[model samples]
Target: MTNWDDFRLVLALARTGAIRQAGAALGVNHATVSRRLADLTRRMGGAVFERISGRYQVTAVGAPVLEAAIRMEAACLEGERRLRAVSPDMAGPVTVSLPDAIARVVLLEELTAFAQANPDISLTLKCSYAYADLDRSDADIVIRGASAPDEHLVGRRLFPYALAHYCARDYFDQVALPDRRWLVRRTPAQWIERSPCPEAPVGYVIDDIDMLHEAAARGQGMIRGACYIAESDERLIRIPGSKVEPWEDLWVLTHPDLRDAPRIKAVMGLVTEALMRSRALIERGETDRCRG
Candidate 1:
């Protein structure tokens, strides 16, 4: 039988190069370190380490085993940390990943309220366009846009992800859109045709939603973006009757293991309620609905 404890002795000895230091680190006597190494070498039919200059020098064959031992220790430590993070108790860390645009415009104030409500649970909001791996626990909860949600996770589907054409409040008044350049994410043929200024030349092709929103707010040019974001910004106004692009279903997802956890459930409930309350703004740029 191969005991990982023996391999750990090998790693500790390799790192420190002295039996006394290895024994102190492992909370064992120096003789126990030497005995364990000798036993491991005998079982493997090779000298795991050689004593030279009163220090343990790893044999050529022992280096690979030591490396494996080090990797195993790191993996175990990470596993323990993850277990602590997902503890059954209500108090612990919870990370939610979502698109930057949504996080900034839709979830900013709602999330602040959630944090205030659950002071025991330390919450972290990670913003990214890329989907986080729920199985690996890249994020405890993730909000994403997807046509087909993963079957493994469980959560609520809020609404359809919608986008429409928009521009600064006084952009057209300052410059005729046909004469100015178009601000767009990508040059999609269909989108170009649907834009308010289809004949307008390209001004800036910004793929990042934040930058695109900024440019449009600054009266750079017309942009097509998420209705929730565009509607929330007072500086931006929707292009009248512009084609609305329905992208995908917006969902809040969590791993099955955490589906029933108290803190995760609490956060998910808040998000679902918030989205439900503002579904019109997110699904349609109904400026009147949100405006007081």
Candidate 2:
């Protein structure tokens, strides 16, 4: 009988190149990962990996087995998700991934209240602008602002949010607005069509949102951001009558396994409640910021 569960241990060690990295990702102690790796080596008859100069490398014999090990890894994840889906009442930990802006502006402040009410539930928040892997169970839930994601996800609309340009009041007051000294994204020419000046930004273009946002925040230069974020932060003030694009939906998504879990529902409801409370600022940005 083959223990494919042991193969997952092999794959994790193989990809991570060291026992420590694999342990961190799998949330186990280094000693436990080491023990499992040793246990797995014996059953496989020949050594699967060799440590050379502080790096783990797969042997030629082990290389061919990697493809099959990966398939077992996928099956193990699917099985875990299925068990979690079936066990609706169990709760211990749930992980959520979202952008730093949203997490800081909203979730961080209110999580304490939820924690007090549900003492048994522990929440882990991962802050990143990148899309986390739901298939790998990177997070049990995620908040995203965009169109839809892959067909496998179970997602729901929280609300539609608007985008707008903002700058520190003092910056605009001192330097003057739209004088070609500001930071700009090379969006479609249609985006440049409605600037306060007949001549739009001629230089100093930055494409990354974080750089553009930091420039605007420090009053170095101006850039656009989601209204709910820019308006909530007292550090930034919206530039009224600026161009407004159409609103996009903010989503709460989870693997289908968690689609009906009570604790997941409670946390998501808290987030939706927060969004509703922010509705006034969201709408104000849409009306006050659109130029044409």
Candidate 3:
């Protein structure tokens, strides 16, 4: 009888392409990966890996074992998702991931209300720019900016926004609109071209737009501010005569596997409803952030 442990070891080693790398990926020491390999070989009467210059490579004999292992992992993950969806009680951790900006303002507040409403369901969160792996259980839900969604999951529209140029009043008066001190997003900075002098065409490049907005508000530089932000901050004023544009779409996404589960359904419905409360304004970026 083959166990999941045996299958996992073989697959991890093969996928990593080296025992040491596999060990690192699995959070185990190289010796443990090596010992497991020897144990499995003795039990199955097969050499699963060939050592070449201290690196272990999967052998032809091991390929089938690795294939089986991958299938097993998929089955197990799907089974877990199913169990979560169908649990009789709507109580357990429902992890959500998002970018820090959304996490701080909308998702966090909505999640707080959800936790209050569904007292039994706990909300866990992660904030990052990197996408969470839904298939691997990194998060049960995600809210982020997207042009489109993955075919494997279901996504609901959260909002649309207009992006406009804004700067702190003091910075605008001192730095000039096209000066190097003007805060700009990475792509636009490169597109606009760099100039060394203050009078020369230049912009401050920042990867995080949310942070860029905050910096601009603090008089550090100028940047693209979400319309929701501009409407509220008197200190931050939009650049005169500069055309702004619609930003990317925002989405709340989850695996279809949990759609039927009561807890997941409850939370998903709540979030969708809360975001939609500002539907008209969010669609056009015509309302203030607080109102939305």
| Model 2 residue pairs with clashes | none
TM-scores, in order shown?
0.69, 0.70, 0.79
Q: Write the per-residue lDDT of candidate 3 for residues 51-109, one digit (tens) a residue.
A: 77776777787777878888889999999988888777788879878776555644577
| Lowest lDDT block of 10, candidate 1 | 283-292
lDDT of each: 0.81, 0.72, 0.71
- Residue-wise lDDT of candidate 2 within 186-279, one digit each (tens)? 7453554565433546447776665677777777766667776776656676675676554767788889877787777778778778766766
Q: Between the candidate structures 2 and 3, which one is better when assessed by lDDT?
A: 2
Measured by lDDT, the strongest candidate is 1
Error of 3 at 61 (Å): 3.3
Choose the strongest candidate by TM-score: 3
Each prediction's number of clashing residue pairs: 0, 0, 1
Which stretches of model 3 miss by more than 4 angstroms?
Answer: 14-21, 38-59, 176-179, 182-205, 228-235, 279-283, 288-292
The residue pairs in collision within model 3 are 183-222
Q: Which segments of model 1 are wrong by more than 4 Å?
A: 1-86, 289-292
